[model samples]
Target: MQIQKINLGAEPSGIGGDSARTSNGKVNTNFDAVVAEFADVRASIPSVTSDLGQSTTIAISQKLFTDTLMSQFNDIGVQGALGFGTGITNKLPTGMSQMQGTAIKGHENWGNYQYSDGSVMVYVPRFYYRWGHVNSPNYAKYGVNALDVKSIYDFVDVVAANAAGYALHRAFYDDGQIKDGFFVDKYQCSNNAGKASSIKNGIPLSSSSANAPFSGLTGAPANTLAGAIDAAKTRGSAFFATTIFIQRALSLLSMAHAQAATSSAACAWYDATGVNNFPKGNNNNALRDVNDTAVLYEGTGYLTAGKTGSAQPFAKTTHNGQYSGVADLNGNMWEVALGLTQTAGSFYVLRTSAKASALTSGATLATDAWGTAAMTASYDSLGASYGELTGVVRNFAIGSTTNQVFSTANSGLAWSASCAGIPQLGGAGGTNAYGNDRFYDNRIEHLCPIVGGNWSYGAYAGVWAVHCYFSRTNGDHHFGVRAALYSV
Candidate 1:
């Protein structure tokens, strides 16, 4: 017996066939057709044989019937049974290729890829988020209401749309097809020989060296940010650690902590008394992981003396407390974020040309002086437009009466939230809830943004920390660099 085809015609409209019914026509004919199709299906079942048990005969008949029915359907039916085609292909973005490496245990979302210079990169897929208070008290005080979660693309599109015609916007949206996510250095960028690398035991490159690696002024090896970008641009994709990229990285890491909480309760990461999900790097004076109580340096003397990227204690310094998340985002060293500048008490995202000038200007914001706006307007605009994306207000000033401070008692010091949407400035309240990550800014000087607190910051270093006190040309030993790749 063979399975017969049943023609249902044009879906909803033809599902019931004719509305008008006559005793010998329309509905009767439709019923007859359906009954005939059922009869064929019933006839397809094989009879139970004496040699074969009833269960075995029924199983065989079921398989035959299923095979015959499935054969009449489309490829989707076969693919569904085989668990094959998903219609979504996993393609490596430009400037990156798949690498065969030991899998990071328990982290299925993370994978290692390679750049042209053979430096390793970790791929982060895109995600969505919504705003909710960490605790009921925070909700009552801040009056933050829950919002609908949206994808990273939704946020990027808004930024691109709001800041159209700016290089900052283009650098973020036009650089690559980031809708699928992007690549970031597996570890803080290290100086290997004369090139930038992301590997274990290599010395992290300083921002001073990163500005002019071959200047001959600094004795450090050549590992400029430009070189890192060029090395990752084997396929001509934009590759650099821009503010937007760093913000996205922070967002991805914060997602785990943020989504773990109920709509009305505090998130695990945001709970003042809860376990800190963000990793503690070499932020204390002892050069140890404060969270894990592990020493980061062994018999240390100075930079690269006994300390290097992904060192034993530093292994716990990743964004996710594992090798999978971006490493050293909490401390160890401050990483430079390009394309953002604070000039004369205001903030402005630089143009592509201005970004280079920022690296060269030593005394002033002159060369990078195209866009400057008042903090009041800029802060309000940023907070109103994209603040919710991060689940926190941008450039929030900690007040004496406000419980937003790390300690409910301390006050008077103003602090800003990091891209991940957490405030870490030190105040009368001791350190802010997240980590003692501090934000430093000066109204009288032109400064560039350096993120993640440095070693010796003790109780004042975190992923949400940002320091705007250093000029683009003023790089310190504690200033380091991280690389990113935008792929299509």
Candidate 2:
């Protein structure tokens, strides 16, 4: 393929320059004109090089000379765009925010947690933003709209690169702007849920008050784990592997954070007012009050403000945002995540241990990125699976432990035989206020963990909760996914 011409249209420097200029401080109209004329020459070299190969000395010299010249031209363009020369320091780009000063937007400074190694793990804090769509029309009510969008599909890859992390591939780059916002659909998704009807834009707040406007809060948002990821991919051009999903370890860490932030300390479920409200079920809302009945009183009335009076269906409890600095994390839908499972007496999980530092971002999800190591092949050892995977999961959930330390593995395995993969976190239904129920053996066919109690389980939803009762292949109205950005 030919090297694409750098379009310095109007502004000779795409980065920021108003007009082209020379080192001598003269208007560099000549340079721009020359570059434009020879742009086709640079573009055509790809075909020429392919025909000639690299055998002859003359051909090699020509290729190098042309490449160097083009590089110099691009460098000049970048320098002009940036309004600075090479080796200059402390110069801020034009249009940068004076308050933050730093060009980086998504780095979580105020609300963040520290890792064992003393490195800080930043949260995007702001609500999720998808690429390519203009701000949601419901920006006034949702308060999630932004002029720019930032997404990090791979957190491990970002931390590994550290300061130079910007080079890592992300769904949204530094210059990217917020486009379409993915909303939780009020309807459930099936394999056929990929159809047009099921995939409706998120219902805006003012769209319908008679029914709960929040999507996928009670019922599972249709689709398998794989399907959920695919839907996220549709809004962007970036290639994301399984790296975007929440991991078992991260899920537990979030639980601990929530638990610590509460007055009860032991209880992970707390509403906006610090009171524990159960996940809303059919009886809670007029729209959802259908065949299902647990005889429990649950309802969060939408008092013209998009929230309920007693128990809000999908209305984020005030407590959800306190701990993680993220809203609606605890109780809503059971989030499908990357975790462990057992089916036909075989264990399936991500092959490598889920440590933030040991991972790398892949170019594509299906091809070379996520085969054996990213997602492991099913193993024969049911004994190892039960002992290592299942037991650890149980301890983390019921043992009242906080902050399970993550270790660096040498084998590059995301998970070990002794480790039970914590799959999903937070749901809509459960018996406890914190929604800690992992004994649903029927749903745990593959033993995948679903967290944050759903609508069906009132008073049982909390931060350190799990519902590992569903099969990975199964899709319910309670299953949904949350999106995060790595800030690269």
Name the top lDDT candidate. 1
Per-candidate TM-score against the hidden true structure: 0.55, 0.38
The Cα RMSD in angstroms, rounded to one decimal, for candidate 2 relative to the true structure is 20.7
> Candidate 1, residue 184: CA error in Å?
1.3
Pairs in steric clash, model 1: 134-266, 406-432, 407-429, 410-428, 410-429, 436-460
Model 2 ranges with Cα > 4 A deviation: 1-225, 237-255, 258-320, 353-384, 387-397, 400-435, 439-449, 485-487
lDDT of 1 by residue, 23-133 (tens): 224333444454464443454444333333333235435644454332221111110011110001156665566554313222312355776666777655443322333
**What lDDT does each candidate get?**
0.42, 0.29
Count of backbone clashes for each model? Answer: 6, 51
Alpha-carbon RMSD to native, per candidate: 15.6, 20.7
Write down the TM-score for model 1.
Answer: 0.55
